[model samples]
Target: MRRCGPAAYPQPIRRCASCADGDRSLRTVTGIFLALGIGAATGLGLTAASVGRGTGAGVLHIGPWLATPKAGTTEADPYARAVTARLGTLPLALADGLALTAEADDGGQRLDGRCTYRVSGQMPPARFWTLGVVGEDYEPAAPAGQRRAFTSYEVLRQADLPIDVVIAATARPGNWLPSGGAAQIRLILRLYDTPIATTISTSTGLPAITRVACS
Candidate 1:
């Protein structure tokens, strides 16, 4: 019988006392079980930590940039990196509330094929909209197949008319712009230099980006 102590005691060389076996097989089995459990716990802890960090430090989520990941995009939430704010403009410009949102890359889905986003919002009469792509560093994430403008032109319905714009990328081009398989795309909806009558009373809405599968 090996004496195990409170201070750096040597492990017991005892066999299975209940099984009446003098072999060290039971000790080996117990050691293997303990090692597996520890490994599993460590792995789970690291995964949880990664998720927590990603949520706290990354992603843009707000008005113009409200977006979700496409189907089959990621096992985890890829939108964690898309954080939204009324940025790039001043308080006066955003007085009516800056509606902005950004969508991060679904790993590499956008690069493999075409992606479509249906953006709908109830904007002010003087409002305008543009959909642009940006890279991981927040710069323009331009795809190789098409050219894009910095901002969009006038996208209004009519005076006294509610606005609902559907933005998408077309292989043939009806009116939407091209996605170019960008690393990330941000939809910017802005009500230009005017006072909104109903800043607090108006509504804003848009659909998530839907990735079109490659043919």
Candidate 2:
């Protein structure tokens, strides 16, 4: 056998100390970039979620309902403005009306679409009002297609009695706003030309959501 020192083959095997160090450096750089990309994505996701669901820390907290009274005006908070822009919501003016969002029932349970709910009680003083399940909050477009609402004018009511609205996927007796078979849903109460628009302090009261049954 012939004695061979370093050059055994024709080409030189480049496994020097510097080469190992360079490979380690490349790996470190790649890991850092990957970390940065993941962090960026996470941050953006959090921001979108935050904008989609405004926190109660900055807006009104009426039991389970939440709202930004000044969201339609220039005086709206930055977060509210961001939310409005993202949702593409044309909120009613502060002088015209106010909108309240309810994500949970009176028992502090998240409003599930598969279950039936009863919205009862007197509404704030307003010239006109509407109650319906909106698309954004939990966006219920799964089991139902036609999006509809119950208006104060058309909703069946007895002689000056408190109204009872039913939220369910199937048909109901009186006032029925479709909830579809969605996993979750949001109830929006819009009062047009309401006293609560101006005097939110004496906001009469909001409706109560009680879970009736589940399918």
Candidate 3:
């Protein structure tokens, strides 16, 4: 009876409101992804910058000269000059009494320690040793989540035995160290006052990094 103005011309036209909404949602999602990408890039950039400023990455030596420190010498009286002179060469072997292998991969001198320290040798009888994660600045790194620095001296033990120290994180109070699958760690094997001691000569060995992780 009555004719609609535009509808009467030909066919009916349906409104695409849902389609418009979908487009808007897509735009919102794209914006979110972009923001996330930017944040990730910024974080990576900071990490790289920090690494550059630290000793985490540098020319690596498999081992250093003079493996052990003097038995009676104290930290106050360091043998720095004597140690520096010895590190001129590379892959320095521990004296006959000791054995050590760089747990890190050769040519992988980022100072990112990802492997377990395998120290196999006759440890000194009366001496106590420790291994700790130190920063490239030669200080203790900040506490990381779920894991702390592991050392043989810190381990809660009942009886003394031949020391086979593996520096890793652990929650339980026992001999075993729980590695948190960290990206890196400095496997510092230390020997206290003993007849046959192995010392990481000052200004030698591997450098340290600040950002340490358990996993």
For 1-215, candidate 3 gives per-residue lDDT tens digits of: 99679767887677699998999999999999999999999977765553332222222233421232321234312232233233331222223222222334233443343434333334344345554554443334335553334444565544644434444444333443434435543344444443343533343333222223323
Candidate 2 local distance difference test against the native: 0.80
**Candidate 2 RMSD computed on C-alpha atoms after optimal superposition onto the true structure:** 4.8
Better of 2 and 3 by TM-score: 2
Evaluate all candidate structures by whole-model CA lDDT and list the values in order: 0.42, 0.80, 0.41
Candidate achieving the largest lDDT: 2
TM-score of model 2 (CA atoms): 0.73
CA shift of 150, model 1, Å: 7.4
| Candidate 2: clashing residue pairs, number | 0
Pairs in clash, predicted candidate 3: 68-199, 136-208, 136-209, 169-178, 180-214
Model 3 segments more than 4 A misplaced: 1-111, 114-122, 142-153, 156-160, 164-184, 197-215
Cα RMSD (Å) per model?
A: 12.5, 4.8, 15.7
Tens digit of lDDT per residue, candidate 1, span 1-215? 86666766666687567676534677888999999999999977765664432333222333324322221123224333222221322322333333333443323233322455543334444454444554444454444656443343543445554444333345443334555555345544433442432232213333344444443
Q: Kindly give the stretch of ten consecutive residues in candidate 1 with the minimal lDDT sum.
A: 67-76
How displaced is residue 128 in candidate 1, in Å?
3.6
